[model samples]
Target: MKKLTGVMAQALTIDEPVVLTGTAPHGILVCDGGSLDLRGGVDDRLTIEPGGYVLLSGSCQATVSIHEGGLLEVAGTLSGAVSRNDGELWAMSGSCIHGRTLSAAGFFIDLEADATPQEDAPRFRLTGTGHDLGIAD
Candidate 1:
C-alpha cells in the first residue's frame, strides 16, 4: 500500500490501493479499479469515476461526485456535498456526513442508521443493476 501524506496536485489512476494520510487540498479524479483509503482531509472537488472505491475516515470539505461503478464507504466523518449518480454509499455507525447527499433513482444507499442495534453495519450488494432500481429507461 502506497501512502500519500501531502498534497495531490494531479489525478491518480488507482491500480493499487493508496492511503491518504495527509490532506489533498487540490482534489483529484479517480477512475478504473483500486481503492482509496482516505484518513486525512480532501478539499476542492472530488470525482470518482467507474471502478473506483473510496474509504473515507477523515474529512472532505468539497463536493464529491460518484458515478456508476463507484463506491464511497464512510467510516469516520464526512462533511461535504456528496452526489451519487448510480454509485454506492455505505455509511457506518458513528460516522457523520454534514454535507448534502444527492442521488436520483439509480443509486445504492445503506445508511448505518438502518441497521439493527445488534448489527455492526449493513453492507448492501453493489452489483445491483440499474434495472433493479427501475432506471432501465
Candidate 2:
C-alpha cells in the first residue's frame, strides 16, 4: 500500500497489485500497464493513459479522462466530469457518481444487483456511445 500526498508523478507504473490513497489534489498521467487500486478523497483532474487499469473505491471529485485502452472501474463515489476516448468505464453496484457530463466513445458497463437504493448510496451516470449500460436482470 502506498500513501500519496500532494502532487504525483506524471506516469506511474506498477507491477504487482497495490493500493494507493490520495490525501490531496493531484494528477496521474498513466498507470503504465498496471493494476491500481485507489482510495481516498481526490479533488482534481485525473488522467489515465493507455493500458492503465484503475479501480476507484473511495470518493473522487475531479474531472477524469480515460485514454484509449485505459480502464476505470468504480465502486465508490465519483463526482465530476468524465471523458472516455476509446477506453472502458465500469460502474459497479454500490457505487454512485454525480457527474457534470460524461462523454464516452468506447465501452461503458453498468452492473447493478437487485437491491433498493439506500439513502446515502452512490449513484452513477452514463452518457455518449457505449455497448452495455443497464441493470442486470
Candidate 3:
C-alpha cells in the first residue's frame, strides 16, 4: 500500500493502491484496479470506477458515485446534496449519511441515531448525478 497525503486522485486515472490524508480536493476519481484509503473530506465529488475500491473515513459535502462493480466502505459523514451510487456501499455504525436507507447495490449501512429523530416520511429522493472527481491530471 502506497501512502499519499494531502493530494487525491483527480478525474484522470490510476491503477494502483494509494492512501490520502488531510482535506482532499473537491473532485476525486478512483479508476479500475485501484485502491484508495481516503482520510479526508470531499467538498464536491468522489467517483469509484468499476473494479475499484475505496475505504473512506472522511466527509462528503456534495456527491459520491460508485460505478458498477465498485465498492465503497465509509466510516464518516455524508452531508452532501444528493448522490447516486450504482455499486456497492458499506457503512458502519456511527456513520452518517442522508441516504440512510440508500440502496444501489449490495451494502450494509448503519447511520447515526440522530439522523432520524423520529419516523421519517418514508419517501425521499436523492437527486443529481454522483459528484465524482480528484487528480492524476
Candidate 4:
C-alpha cells in the first residue's frame, strides 16, 4: 500500500495504473481535466474537486470520502465503499461494481440502470443536511 498525503496539483495527471493508500489531510485537487488510474487498496480521506476524474480499473478495493465541492467519477470495475459529503458522483455506464457501498449527501448520478444495487449488494444511502439531494438514473 502506497501512502500519500498533502495537496495534489491541479494539473497532475497519472497515466499509469497504481495502488495508493493513505490520507490527504488537506484534500486533493485535480483540475484542468486531470485523470488518474487507481487499483488496489485506497483508504483515504480526501476531496476531489470538480474537473478531477479517477478511473478504477480492473479489481479495486477502496474506501474514499469526498468533501464538499468534490466529484468522484467511476469507470471500469470498482469494489469497496465511497461516501460523499456534499459532493457529486458520476458512475458511468458499462461499469460494474461489486461489494460496493455508495453514500452521498449531495448528488449521485448513475448513468447505467444496472448500477442499481442487487439484493445482496451493499447499501446506497443519501443523507444531505439542508440540501436537496439528487439521485439520477
TM-score of each: 0.68, 0.61, 0.64, 0.40
Off by over 4 Å in 4: 1-34, 39-51, 99-137
State the displacement of the C-alpha of residue 84, model 3, in Å, after optimal TM-score superposition: 2.4
| Top model number, TM-score | 1
Q: What is the lDDT of residue 78 in candidate 4?
A: 49
Clash statistics: count for each candidate:
0, 3, 10, 0
- Rate residue 118 of model 2 by lDDT: 40
Off by over 4 Å in 1: 9-15, 99-137
Specify the poorest-scoring 10-residue window by lDDT in model 4.
Answer: 9-18
Query: What is residue 70's positional error in candidate 3, in angstroms?
Result: 0.6
User: What tens digits encode model 2's per-residue C-alpha lDDT throughout 92-116?
Assistant: 5456556322223222335333322
lDDT of model number 3:
0.59
Instruction: Order the candidate numbers by lDDT, best to worst.
Output: 1, 3, 2, 4
Model 4 lDDT per residue over 1-137, tens place: 23333333332223232243322222333443454444332433333555555544333344454455545555545444555445665544344444332433223334444454333332232333223323453
Candidate 1 C-alpha error for residue 79, in Å? 1.3
Q: Model 2 compared with the native: what TM-score?
A: 0.61
> Per-residue lDDT tens digits of candidate 3, residues 57-110?
677665677787888775656666436667776554445555453322322255
Model 1 scores worst on lDDT over the 10 consecutive residues at 128-137
Whole-model lDDT, model 1: 0.63
Clashing pairs in 4: none
